[model samples]
Target: MCLLDKKAFVDFITTLWNIWNYRNNAIFRGKEEDARVIWERARKLNDDFRIHNFSIWSILPWAPKTCKWDVIKLNVDASMKANRTSLGIIARDLDGFVLSGKAIFINRVVNSESAELDAFLEGIWLAQSLNLDKVIFETNYACIINHFCKHKDDITIFGYHIKKARKMLDSCSKVDIKWVDRGCNKVDYSLCNWSLSNCYNLSVEMDYPSDIHNLVISNVI
Candidate 1:
């Protein structure tokens, strides 16, 4: 399912559902089942379901739009489970070209907000490492954005990290922190999930994980 669009994901699920229903009908109601026809029906149902349930806005691609010409955008996300937090980050230029991406695994337990803060710090460090002084950072966690907005650097154990991140931002020529919906940050979300699954802790420059390529294509298109 790598690089699957939303419609493709929905199609995959609906096909499975259709197969199940067809099997049940054949067993209980003596219906003749044809695989090809069933697949076509499933595809039609998926399209109809999307049309009926989703607005135009919802059907559009989930990736964020490109940033301003002179700005680079970084999307960061994290997945926490048990005693570990997996982080993902991707920096893209205004043309939606990936400058760098990272997948990280933090072997410690933390609350969701703290995990998000760590991911934010990772993004800042990444920007600094790349000498990218003008950046727009995005995340799905609104609370994380609000922490910086209110300067709440003394409320949690990770507060010190937040403060350091702020200092890094100060050194940047320009920086903007924004809260975006999960859908618009799918690349980083997928990277987080990948890191969690594989325990990866490395960064890629001028390259991307294969699974992210399709979604990246959709964004640039």
Candidate 2:
């Protein structure tokens, strides 16, 4: 377990325990469990234990400040309905001013975690489109972040998407990806709602739509 910190080691062992327990139940109690279910259960157990034992989340990094003039804090969000998923991204400056935004609707089916990862890739692409070098991408979802940051390599189907995001980030000069509390992501969530409701994709660099743009500074996180 080279450099597999406390949290990763805990989750890894929890997963093994879950797999063993699932195997026993399947044999004795005739409870058939899928691989996905076992993994999720292990993750839940790990999270619960972490909360009770170490309160690890209290030390999690929040949305970083865009202290420099060129640095931008980009909040990315995703919402899925049926098979269609909407991706929303909004960038703000140090003074909480809107810089760039995107709302993309993709007609495909993917798990919620995978779709959130898709929004993350979209955020990177959005940054590239704006030719940004210093940017901080914030998301409420933690799966992809933990996958890379915590060195969690799992058998989930979304692993490919995570790899894609990794290669995309390598070209950047300064990049930060972190998990922000859901309450702090209301603006992007609203942008996600708008995109899904209209089934439209939008990219704006300046003078963003009056409705969603107004939600940023008012609900600064």
Model 2, residue 188: what's the lDDT?
A: 81
Candidate 1 total steric clashes? 0
- Per-residue C-alpha lDDT of model 1 across residues 1-221, encoded as one tens digit per residue: 87999878888989999999999999999997789999999988977777567565555455533323468999999888767789889899988888888989887767888778778888988887776768999998987777677666477645566666888788667888898888878878777777777776867777666667776777667
Worst 10 residues of 1 by lDDT: 60-69
lDDT of all predictions: 0.80, 0.79
Q: After superposition, how far is residue 10 of candidate 2 from its true place, in Å?
A: 72
Task: In angstroms, give how far residue 189 of model 1 lies from its true place.
Answer: 0.6
- Quote the lDDT for 199 in model 1: 74
C-alpha positional error of residue 184 in candidate 1 after TM-score superposition, expressed in Å:
1.0
Best candidate (score: lDDT) = 1
Candidate 2, superposed: residue stretches over 4 Å from native: 1-69, 151-157
lDDT of 2 by residue, 132-213 (tens): 7788888988876777574446556577667667778786688888889988788788878777878888776668777765
After TM-score superposition, what is the CA distance of residue 210 in candidate 1 from its true location, in Å? Answer: 3.3
